[model samples]
Target: MIASRKQWRCKVNSCRHTFSVTSGTIFANHKLPIQTYLYAIALFVNAVKGISALQMARDLNIEYKSAYVLLHKIRKALLEQREFTTFSGEVDIDGTYIHPAPRKANKKIDRIDYRLKENQNPEKRCILVAREHYTAEEKAKNPLYRGAKSTQVVTFGETQSTVKHFADKFVERGTRINTDESHAYDVLYAILRFMHGKSQGRIP
Candidate 1:
């Protein structure tokens, strides 16, 4: 006799174990209906900028905890499982200071807060980005041809030590490094025998 949809029964003499559609799959032990899974997947796939767990919870009419777990499982499956290679060839690096969003206005207080001003705030965070430039031949064969092949994002102060540390960790020796006229990158000259190119203005 044939088994039901996604259901199976072992015919072995020692065991006649039964299992359902979710057996041995990521969807195993799921209480929600199959249609719910399909809908959730469609939402995730169709989202252009990506969706948050709270948004998914609202869309699926499910609890936040369930939506959070479901989203993580889906993300884990979609991520590429492999080792990352260090960046080589021409590399561009830059740093920028990111400020937190302004706090919401309070009806109780009418006075402006001077401490949160741009110049007065010492809580600004810095982000350093390294992008590897690709050649025409590399672009033609690469799946992601529109942008840099490898990128590293580091969160630290934009200082000489930070820049040198980032270069040592992500960039290969003897590789040409390109950046705007920033004194922080001066350390690269002493650390490695790299071809350093400094631009007069902002680099595209």
Candidate 2:
């Protein structure tokens, strides 16, 4: 039986089912042409500052809804294909809050205190990111090795609990972790001490 590149059948006698190259994957049942998908990916990757759905639509000459869905599909595929690995050597961590602010009340007396955490916008979410730097050996071996070797991002509420959890799960013990002055990372102090003691055989 001849196997076509786009569509093929199983060689087995009992399981001669037919399938295509994009079967059982994120690109399955794609509406856009293969070249368009490739071009979209190129635009997405080349966008250092990031590209919006509207921007992608204009660049790719596609509808706004199509561009938005395609962009989200790419993001979902990346998250689904993640290879979980702990960061070692040196790791940098930071967080930032992002959300569209809600409209205020018409009168001054109706305004609420936005500064207080309790009254702050509930839609706001903090985006936490951790990047692992390449080891000395890696830098020496690879001539074009950039600073960050790998990056992990978390959108689940950023706080002391979340930061600690991320470090414990993603970071390797005895590795140096760098973070900003945000209190969210303050938990790392105790975590570092525990790891250091455990490595030195001081902690049971």
Candidate 3:
């Protein structure tokens, strides 16, 4: 049997199924054209904070349900294709607390803000960041050096166990690590087999 423009036909007697360009892929079994699917993918990838399904539907002129399914499939495919890499060389680690969005209240009550007060919110979210510092020569040659070097971000409390866990998981042994004078990082010396450097000031 001859294969059509968009489908392939199997020559074997046992398997004569026909499939399109999107066969066995996330875009399969969709009514939209391949170009529309590709355009949606481009929008999804380029969105830094990510786009909602409703926005995607409006942009692609498709139904909300279709957009939702399309976005989910795209995310699943991307997650399946992702790879993890360990960081080496000089790495800077630090943690910062992020305050939750303040609840909206009446004008008079809203004026009494306590967000700036120290220790006002003990359950604030913590963000742990580990960034690889590049040498001068490496920075010059690196194409993605327009901003900071590659960084790994995790959400966890600032504790000795958390710091040590991040180091063991993402950092390679013998790699130099720099951090501020926080007691939480003390566990790194015992657990992570790396050269540790403490700074009195904040890590750049």
Candidate 3 local Cα displacement, residue 29, angstroms? 2.1
Using alpha carbons, what is the TM-score of model 1? 0.52
TM-score, each model?
A: 0.52, 0.77, 0.63
Better of 2 and 3 by TM-score: 2
- Compose the digit string of candidate 1's lDDT tens values, residues 26-111: 78878888888888899999998899989999999999998899988787666544234667777778788767445646764854
Question: Residue by residue across 128-186, what tens digits does model 2's lDDT show?
Answer: 77788777788898768775655556564778898888888888888777665556767
Q: Per TM-score, what order, best first?
A: 2, 3, 1
The lDDT-based order of candidates, best leading, equals 2, 3, 1
Error of 1 at 192 (Å): 16
Candidate 2 Cα misplacement greater than 4 A, ranges? 1-6, 10-16, 100-111, 117-119, 143-147, 190-204
Model 1 RMSD in angstroms: 6.9
lDDT of 3 by residue, 61-172 (tens): 9999999999999988876774456777877788887775466566875554565666256666778877777888888898686544444444647898888888888888
Q: TM-score: which is higher, 1 or 3? A: 3
- Given candidate 3, what's the lDDT at residue 56? 96
* Model 1 spans with C-alpha error above 4 angstroms: 1-50, 59-61, 70-82, 95-127, 140-144, 180-183, 189-204
